[model samples]
Target: MSEVYDRLRGEIVDGTFETGAQLVELALAERYGTSRTPVREALRRLEQDGLVERGDRGMRVRTRSPEEILEIYEVRISLEATAASAAAQRHSEFDLIRIRRAQAAMDSTSTDDPAAMAAANRAVHEAIWVASHNGTIVDLLTRLNNHLTRYPATTLKVQGRWAEALDEHRALIDAIEQRDAARAHDLARDHMTKARDLRLQIYREDPTA
Candidate 1:
């Protein structure tokens, strides 16, 4: 049931299924080759995650407005900045290796596939969060980040931000490697700040967004 929910949730976040679309249980159950019971369970979980909402008509994919997106980004900046700071102060060598691997993957396919880039992007962030060794912060970041895929990739598509993002990743890794908590926190906050500005700009310009 959790797997089914995650699959549907991914589709919704990644825009494979657009916002406000009907999610009929029978159809989703058939498509996923599962019983309606799991699909129903997935839907319930989706509501808890804020990925879907119950309506008078039925279940509908939630739509994130520009303001809401900005608000989410703001919360992300605060939480993730602290995570990076904690990680820098506490990261193990093994954690640094995992972060490097994720960054390398991002650098490799960055131009080839946007979806893969996004996934790699997530991997890097999660690696840093895990390094912090604070389960509560990790849980908060997990929930806050789950909604980000709603933004069109156009923001990440911005010329050089993807590459710039890689540079930021490098800087973050460097801070963690050196165990410099202040630098890591500042770099992480700066990274999120830049992303927030660029994404908000893109959203304002995208009529379909």
Candidate 2:
């Protein structure tokens, strides 16, 4: 059940299923080479996770409104700041290396490749969340992040956002490494705020978004 759920959830989050794509239990079962029972169970779990929604069109991958996206980011700002602050005070040397290595990977990836950039960017942020060593904060951020993926376009695709975001990530890592909790907190808040702004801008420009 867990394996089926995880696989289905991954597909939705990664855009394999796509936003607003109808999810039929029979089709999913056949695609996953499983019985309809497990597929049905996975769909139920996805609905609970807010990844699947029931509408006039029936069950489909959820699509978020701009307002919903902004609201999620507002909560994200507070939570991300908390995580960065805690990370600055508590992260081990290994944690610091993890964060840096993630950034290094992002740097090595071509900015022209938005998909690679976004994945690398997530790696950097996720590393910091893990470095925070706060279970509750990490869990909350992870869930919030899944919601953000509902809109599949990456904010890094915005003109000039990729380089700017990379620099911000570097500064954030430096603050964390220096054990500057206040600076780390402020940097995290600013990073997410800019990201939210860019996301809305991109969304507004896309009629289908």
User: What residue runs in model 1 are displaced by over 4 Å at the alpha carbon?
Assistant: 14-16, 26-35, 152-154, 207-209
RMSD of every candidate to native, in Å, equals: 2.2, 2.2
lDDT tens digits, residue span 161-207, model 1: 88899899999889988989999999999999998898788777883
Per-residue lDDT tens digits for candidate 2, residues 18-66, read 7789998888888889898998889887887779999786789887688
Compute the lDDT of residue 103 as modeled in candidate 1. 85
Cα deviation of 60 in candidate 2 (Å)? 2.5
Model 1's number of clashes is 0
Candidate 2: RMSD to truth:
2.2
Error of 2 at 21 (Å): 3.8
Error of 1 at 92 (Å): 0.9
Pairs clashing in candidate 2? none
What lDDT score is found at residue 8 in candidate 2? 92
